[model samples]
Target: GESVGLHLPTLSVQEGDNSIINCAYSNSASDYFIWYKQESGKGPQFIIDIRSNMDKRQGQRVTVLLNKTVKHLSLQIAATQPGDSAVYFCAEKKGSNYKLTFGKGTLLTVNP
Candidate 1:
């Protein structure tokens, strides 16, 4: 995913814990959103997606919450592990346009 010019700092966590990541979007017309996970040396892989019509979406070990009013979004990760260490990203799409703007990436570090 493309970085939205601002790169979020990294987060380190212990194993068997939960992690929460947050982002703020600039566009109000964005109709679609997705969360992606990227491990070292790999591109981002889609984790989940939600539409403007919906406020929340979930996936295995992950949940996304969106607040259109504040243009805020967040991702929650359960069961922190060494393998879970990676970079996470949130992407948004505008109405009828396939172009996507990625939020600053967050690097998650899980301490075993």
Candidate 2:
């Protein structure tokens, strides 16, 4: 089976800084997209989503940009902090059931 993984399993940053998590996927036919923030020992929470028809979307303190041409996606967090430290994942809806294929994971380290 194919798998999605992050280039960096862990990322470190200082408080009040910006963080960027990158994801690379193999399935180019995937359609819908979503970014999730997961704290230690917790389930992932939806950050933002984008459809194949669009290229970018933004949310409070967060932004998601999809580049279908290259099969790449990224999540940008503004003013990252201790609370923002967590693992981030990028998922795509690849089937009729809207099944999500999640990237391995990225741990964000925010230094306060």
Candidate 3:
């Protein structure tokens, strides 16, 4: 059986600090993982992605780490700012499937 979704987690951070959000996937067959950030009243936006073949991938002000051994994924945001506050989600897809299974999202709040 596969997990369809998860309970949302909340993360609070101070401005100028770093934030780390973690996600766990139930499907080990999933090869592609993507991170998305969604602001209030807006759709999810692409953040970063990593393949199972790679352990880590970096983007502007963001880093994604994948641990296939534990079916875990994490997103690290550098220099947390108020504008960076959003709900972040991790999505996984396997093979040629166009559908992505999304994990529980984490709401990040950056306080000044």
Q: Global lDDT for candidate 3?
A: 0.89
Worst 10 residues of 1 by lDDT: 1-10
Candidate with maximal lDDT: 3
What ranges in model 1 sit over 4 Å off?
A: 1-8
Model 2 CA deviation exceeding 4 Å by range? none
lDDT of 3 at 17: 98
| lDDT by residue (tens digit), candidate 1, 61-108 | 988898889788888889988988888888988888878888778989
Judging by TM-score against the true structure, name the best candidate: 3
Give the per-residue lDDT digits (tens) of candidate 2, residues 1-112.
6656678999999999999998877787777888999998889999999887888788998988888787888899999979999899988887575578888889999998
Q: What TM-score would candidate 1 get against the native?
A: 0.90
Number of colliding residue pairs in model 1? 0
* Pairs of residues at least 3 apart in sequence or in different chains that clash in candidate 2: none
The ten-residue window of minimal lDDT in model 3 covers 1-10
* True-structure RMSD, every candidate: 2.8, 1.2, 1.5
Q: Write the per-residue lDDT of candidate 3 for residues 19-64, one digit (tens) a residue.
A: 9898888888898999999999999999999999999999999999
Ranking by TM-score: 3, 2, 1
